[model samples]
Target: MTLAFTCKKCDTRNIYKISRVAYYQGIVICTCSGCQSRHLIADNKGLLDFPEFGRNIEDYMESQGESVQRLVLSNTGVSTQDSSTRLSPDDSGNES
Candidate 1:
């Protein structure tokens, strides 16, 4: 099955099949490292929950060294910016 992961912060979200761990799994970080306001304000216990479909960020954070945090944060920022730009204004409100 395909799985999706989204950051509680910035917005970098991605999808991968169950077996894609080596290359495509959603790596989670537990040190409250997400780059979004949501993540910054979120409790550690709940950070992984709102993203809904991600692997346990803490597992990867705990196991991996600190080398990848920058990369992850970059991706998250891109995702958040891209998502905000693509949002569709509710048609119920008005179409412009």
Candidate 2:
């Protein structure tokens, strides 16, 4: 699924292609290609509770106009450094 949101650091519009599996995970970390700043995307009740997450993001994107940067989420995990690096469920950055 595709997600669109504005970067808080750079104010640049970003579009991310997220995997459906990510919804099951605890947290999702998104990096803005424009400023290389990282943004955390998460749902307190968990993404499973909100099936419309993708749709909501799409709506926000449409309302914001054009998106300048695009990123794709890998099946294994979100790559913060290299392709070999994968963030497991334990590394979701959530202590809870």
Best by lDDT: 2
lDDT value for candidate 2?
0.60
Identify the runs in model 2 with alpha carbons over 4 angstroms from their true place.
Answer: 43-96
lDDT of 2 by residue, 24-82 (tens): 44456689989999765554344445544443343334556844343436665565443
Q: Could you give me the TM-score of model 2 versus the true structure?
A: 0.41
- The sequence of per-residue lDDT tens digits that candidate 1 reaches over residues 4-23 is 45664566675444433422
TM-score of each: 0.21, 0.41
**Segments in model 1 whose C-alpha atoms lie over 4 Å from true places:** 20-96
Candidate 1 clash pair list: 10-36, 28-57
The candidate that achieves the highest TM-score relative to the unseen native structure = 2
lDDT score of residue 75 within candidate 2: 66
Error (Å) of candidate 2 at residue 7 is: 0.8
